[model samples]
Structure formats: structure tokens, C-alpha cells
Target: MKHIKFSISLLLLLVFASCEKELDLQPQQSIGIDAATATPENINGILLAAYDIGRNTSPDNLAPLYNGNYSGYLNISSELLGNTDQVSWNGTFDYLRDIFNKALINNNTGALNIYSDSYAIMGHVNTVLANLDKFDDAAERDRVEGEAKFLRGIVYFDMVRFFGQQYNPAGNNSQLGVPIILTPPDVSIRIERNTVEEVYTQVISDLTDAFAKLPDDNGARADKYAAQAILARVYLQQGNYTGARDAADNILQNSGHSLTATFAEAFDTDDNPSETIYSWVITQQEGTNISNTHYATEALGGRGGDIAITQAYLDKFDSDADQRRNFTYPGEGVSTGLLLTSKHVRQFANATPVRIAEMHLIRAECNFRLNSSVGLAPLDEINALRARSSAPALGALTLDLILNERELELAFEGFTLHDYKRTQRNIGTLSWDDNKLVFPIPQSARDRNPLLEQNPGYN
Candidate 1:
């Protein structure tokens, strides 16, 4: 695929690891200046940066995007290269750092604004919560406070995942993750990484409060159901099976969300379908280099192809019944077998987070992991998805199959690598080597923080 040139389009191509965290260029000025005194409109403008970063973190450009897409392509190749789908310089990881690195080097304080942006909103929440008297009406204060909390929760949640380990209840405190920057950290705060569990605990706490603060549904923004779904994902990663199962079940039962009948329509971009629980809006940029749908086409376009799905990933849904097969079409001039990702095909529209279907799948996995005796729940969930593929449901469900299916079903949505980490699946391996399982903690992080430690086996 042709490499898309970095231009003004690329400047607006803000990349986020998730809705929760971001990489900010060092600020020219401290975030400590009291933004609390700003008018509500200015505060809202500050908050928009968080949302902007969240929207730009397209699944196509995330690290796993390269991993899943290119690896999937290589798996189909008969050559079986030792270098299959690996992100060795010419991959998703490289593109991901482009925006942040540029911003860092140029000292673009605009990027640094995300830190203050998030807390500035949080400050609004605090202001409202602490001084309901300022708002004249209790309902207005409560609603505004809830919106602030939801934004805060989403931002923190994203950061924790990118900068820290997956939440492992058994060893949470021992896990070094992102430093908790709840309030704008003071210049002398000298941040330290918190335990993964602590980060997750705070996320859960923030979301839990958000659920109470939010209504049942909030149109395009996050609502009670979105918070619940996020909480369920956090629980699953933490090995809190019951919590995951319950949170998921609550959404399925109470939130009026449901899966679209066919897999093809599920991800269509022309209109925002009902299944998206929460998402950030993206304005279509014609020349933007990072369109996820263009993944398959980009490489063949001649600029430069960073990653394309391997044949193995395509083969996962080779069954005639799988409707997802039709959704994936070959990019122009591409070889026959490589399938381009069809998950986000909009010429331009907002990205949607999974609504009901994802939560249902989470419940099934949680129950399956808990070894539920009913068995029917997992079967039912699998069948629901299988029905979309037009494939028959397989025999008994196992964590392995569910894990594999989740990858197949949600390949480019940015969960693959993290899921691999959380489940402790062997990463960095073509075969069954354990050494490739965890990422080397950026050596730079260790050099900066003496208390930081690397994942086992990396050294």
C-alpha cells in the first residue's frame, strides 16, 4: 500500500490509544493555572480536546491494528515467513507514534492541553458537586456533574490500559501502570505509577458514579449502559468473572440495545446504527492517511502499505455461512486472498463502541470462564454470532474458541493485543514460544522511574 503523506490532514489526525488516555507534548505552561475560573463555554472547549483525541485513535492505526491486519495477511501466505505480520519498522506501531512524536518534538502545547483539558472538565464536576448552590437548581448541577464524571472516567480508562498492565485482581497492587493524575498534577507532584488494580478501581468508581449521574441513554455520548459495558470489560480483564457477567447481563436486560441482524450492516458508516453503545464523532477527511477501511487498499495504492490482513485471519471466517466474508472485499490491485478490514468503511462518520452484542459476548465468556453449569448461555451467545456468519454453532464452547472468535469478530476494533496480554496469550511468537508474550516496557520508562520493573522474561 502507498504510504499516505503526513500533511495538514495528518495534523488533525489525532491518534488516541483509547477514549481514556493520551500522549501529550510537554506543556509550555503548567496545567496548574486555575481553569476553574473560566466561563462554562471555555471549560467545554477544553473538554473537547479529550473527545478529539478519543475520536482520532482509530483502530486502524493502533499497534494491534498492524499486528492483527498484517499478521492476518501473512497467515494466508504459503511462504510462512519468519517475519510474518510483524511490526518491524514498517507497521502500525510506526504510524501510531507519528502524531505524538511530532507534537513532542515541536513542543506543540496543543497536544499538552489534553492533561489540562481532562482535569478542567473534572474541575467543573468538582465545582458543581461541591457547590450545588452555584447552580440554583439541583437537577442542573447533578446532570452537569455526571457528564463531567463520565468524561473523566473515559479518559482515565484509556490511559490506564495504554500505560499500565491489564487489571489482574490477583496481582493488581504489584502491577505498575499509569500515574493517577486526577486533579491537574502540580509541577512538583513527581508522579508515580499506580497499581493496575488501583487504576481499574478508580475507573470502576468513576464509571459507577457516572452511571448514577447519567440517564439510561444519552444519544451519541456515553450513558448508563456504556458505563456498564466498560465496567464489564474492566472486570473481565481483572478476572472478576462474576462482576463481568453481572455488568454485561445488566446491559442486555435493561439497555434497549441489540445486535443488527446481519454482520455487514453492523459496522456500516452511512448512518450511525443503534448498536453503538458509545462513540466519538469523526469528520471525514478525504486525504487522511489512517482510514481503517482503507487498510486493505492503502498498501496496494503504492504510497506505502503498513499492514494488511493475513490469509489466516481471513480463513477464520472462510465458512460459506459467515456474512462477514462479504463485508471484506479486496482492495484495488491487491493480491487475491488478502482481505481488507471492513469494520469501519465510512467515507466519514463517527466511530461507535460496541453496544449490546459486545456485552452479551462478555457475559458468555465470563460465564464460560466461571464454568457455569447452565451451558445454554454460552451456546446461545455463540449461536447469535454464528447466525450472523450463517455458520452453524460448534460443539462445546471453550475459552480458547471464545478467545479466537472474539479476535475474528472484533479484529480491528483495537482489543486484540490487549486481549492477548490480559489473557496471557503468547505474543511475539509465530509458534508456541512464551518469551514473546509481553511487550518490553519502553526502556525509557525504566530509565526515568527507578521503581518501575519490566514484565517477566523480557530481560
Candidate 2:
């Protein structure tokens, strides 16, 4: 499951979305930059290309290679790695099976792509930042910088969480995080894993800057609230309840985003629903949707059903009346008896990175924990989401109940493993902080960079 290194391959990351050209980077810079990176259009092209981070050219549909960082892997990988009894990875892809079994080695292709892609995105955004002065308009310049920072902050936050030990707010958190690479590195530069605290601080810095510079309306790219949304999640992960609550409040109150009319209306189409805060749109010509490729059955245009829902996941629902529970279909062929998710059934649906519903959940949990209602009462927030599915509401609530509600609402949208670790809950028999849950630094990376140290337990 080894892969060719992505360090060079990701250098040519700027192309028109309509063209959908394959990314092929060599040792030299492929895109020309004349007279301080030439025109503003060139800068914009580079920025747009940052979202399409497909690396794998593999022909296998079962292991579709459209590896955009914002794709289904972000959520699916988290679901598999921290799986308790909720879902089963019955797929033939060995790399994914390893993640499900918690038996991953450094050479695992899935793990390597995730690790390498995070770094490659950082590198891509760095290029964008370096050429920001190319734009003559001051307002456009600030917006471009904000978007680049947003891209870097989002991937860096994901990298630190997946690659470093879970952050403990009360502790100093001196643990090794992935390197904080602000500038693109050449062959001569050595790298080191910054501390968990350093990475988290950098993420906050980048997002905070993005929040200030980004506009209220910028089409589909990261806007002001988008930065705030990621900041809220970052604050929650770091146990800053007050900060988390405040950020979520900003999104819920002023983002002008709202919930879908029904649970079934939330997905499948491009993330154009009012609920989506940030998304990466995938036209059929742009790239294939990895979620659909893996989550759907052959009849629906996916490979043999790979990811399936389990009875345990169904039991979490309050009743059959809950509409989200109805999003089920019998599995394909050999796995016909199993159940698969209906959330991902289209090949070109947008990969939603953040949703308005996520902010609501964060606000509810933070409010309950602090015993202070910042936006809506905790119970009201929880019930608001439940009402979408016509699920029965409860008269009282506990932290566990709120957390459970969060799980049910965010199913297949990512945030499972992060939530489990943050709440100090175990994945079945495994401890919440099990080393197996953290991805090993890809061996290929270490072979190239001597200064980059590995996470413990993969050796």
C-alpha cells in the first residue's frame, strides 16, 4: 500500500476547475510567475485549484483516487478509525480494512495519502500567500490572503488532530504535532514536528486572520463564518467551552444559514443546501465523489458496498419515526443482508466540510457544559435538530444525552473520533487515547525528511 511521494506531485496545483487537469508536479515550478506573479487572474486560478487535491490515479473504482482533502475520506476515515459498534468496513480495500481494525502501519496508502495531502495543501497555500502581492486591488489582496489562510488553517487543524496526541487543555500539551510549514520547503530544508500546542496556536492564528479578512459573501469559498465554524470546533477540541460557545453563537445567529426542511433533504445534491457552511463542489468532470464511490452499491454506480451501517447504529435512534434512520438500503450482492447509508449516493455531490447544524450542536453542548445558555437553551437546541426527523423529544438532559444527540446528528459528516477523544470516551474496549487511533507519520515522509520524527507505537 505504498505510494509515490506527494511532495513534488502537489506543486502544480493551480488549474481552472472546468479543465479538471490532473495534478503532476516535478522538481521545478511548472506554473510561471512573471513580474511578481503576473496578473490577479493567475492568483485566483491558483486559489481555486487548491480545493481540487486529487492525488491517486488508481483505476480501481473500489479505491477511487479523487483524494480531495474535503472529500468523504475526511469523514469516512474518522468513522472507520474510531469505529465502536456503529458501522462495519466489509470492503476489500486492505488499507481501509487496516484502519477499521486499528492495525495500520506507516506504509498504509490511505494513511499516507491523508498525511501527505495535509502537508501538500499547506505547501499549495503557501504558494498562494507568497504571490498575494500580484493583485493590485487592496480588497482583493486581503480576500485572497484570507482564503489561503483558511485553507492552511483547516488542513493544519485536521493534521494535528489526526497525527498528534489528543490535546488536553489543563496540560501543557508539549506532544509532537505535524510540522508548522508556513512557507514552501525546498530539498535543502529540514522539518520537525512542532508541539501540539504550537500547531493549535497556529491554527487559531490562521483562522482568526481569515475571519477578519474574509468577506460576508464570497460564493462557495471560505467566508467569515466559515473561519468561525472551524474555530469553534478547534476551541471545543481544546476544551475552551466559552470560546467554542461564542464562535458557534456567531455562526448560528448571523451566518444567514439555516437547516434543511427535512433530514432527507440534507444531502446527495451539491452542498448548496442552506445548511452547508463550507463545501467543495464536485462536478462530474471535475472529480468523482469518493463517498458515493464507496458508500453506494453497484446498482447505484458504486463499487460493491464497502461501508455499511450496523444494528448498533440503528439502536442509537430513538425510534423508527426518526427520518434519518430511514436512510437505509439493503447492501449489494455478497453483503445483501447488510445496510448502507443513503447520505452518499451521487457521484458529483459536493463534499460539505462544515454545516450550520454542526454549529448548533457545538453551541448546545457548550451551553449545557457551562450551565449557561448563550444562544438557545441546550434542550431547545437538541430538540430543534431532533424535530427535523420527527424524533421524540425528552423533558430532561444529561451530558451523555447531549453527546449522544451530537453523534446521531453528525453521522457520516465527520467529527466522530474527535468527539470520542475530546469527551474521554473509549471506542469499545479501547481507551479514548489509544495510540492505534492516531495515524502514524507516513514512512515515505520520514525517508525524505530526517528531521521529521514519528508518532509512537507505529514502530
Best by lDDT: 2
List the candidate 1 regions with Cα displacement exceeding 4 Å: 1-36, 57-134, 285-305, 333-338, 373-376, 428-459
- lDDT for residue 343 in candidate 1, whole number 0-100: 59
Give a tens-digit lDDT track for model 1, residues 1-459: 111211111111232122222222223333332443244433333333334433332223333211111111211111111123421112344323332122122122222233333333343334334433445455554555566667666656655554455555576366665556555323334456677777777888888887787778565556778777878877887778898898888887778777777776666453456666765444443122133433435443322223446665656663766776555655454334444556544534444445566776788888888877232478778777777768777877778888877766766665655566567654434322232322334443344445545554444
Clashing pairs in 2: none
lDDT of each: 0.51, 0.77
TM-score of each: 0.71, 0.91
lDDT of 2 by residue, 17-47 (tens): 1121111122343444353246687666556
Q: TM-score winner among the candidates? A: 2
> Candidate 2: where are CA atoms >4 Å away?
1-26, 29-36, 54-66
